[model samples]
Target: MSIAEERIDRLHTLAKQAVAAREFDRSREYVRLARRIAERNRCGLPREFKRFSCPRCDVYLRPGVNARVRTQDGHVVVTCDCGELKRYPYQS
Candidate 1:
């Protein structure tokens, strides 16, 4: 069967127990399943996840253990080997 159909079937079965007992853990599992199904169907996320951005350059921010920054104007000036800060937009 199709991924969406499979997810819908599982969701239907899980819905009863998930709602009846207010089982958040089980409900979360269902949510994950839904996400997987959406991905499989190329349907995309219901909502995007929030991401941090760079203040000085108005660029996308990516933090790493080895990355260093200089502090200025209450914000860190990020310098990368590529000479440009990578921007990561919200994706769900």
Candidate 2:
């Protein structure tokens, strides 16, 4: 894989572990890093996408465009612009 891809993969993995361990703060940081990598690599996501929503509508504040941030601790929930914050289970 390309360097960007590799970085993204690593970041995702770390985030996942952190989430599973309940390290929300760490997971958030990793997610933010992953999002930066995705943005730098021009992931080709839809323009109107804007952000990602949690599957459960508990928390809707992700660091990337429609990104699923995760770690070993658990998942960081996100609120959807749809008016409800949701919780989504994800893997880093």
- TM-score for candidate 2, please give it: 0.49
**Total clashing pairs for each candidate:** 1, 36
Q: Give lDDT tens digits, candidate 1, residues 10-90.
A: 564564356356564564466556556766787543221112222232222234521245555445455543465433333
lDDT of 2 at 13: 68
Candidate 2 on 1-92: residue-level lDDT in tens?
A: 67877786676667656656656667667666666777889873222222441323322244443333434456655444344544545566
> Least lDDT summed over 10 consecutive residues: which range in candidate 1?
46-55
| Candidate 2 wrong stretches, greater than 4 Å | 44-92
Each candidate: what lDDT? 0.45, 0.52
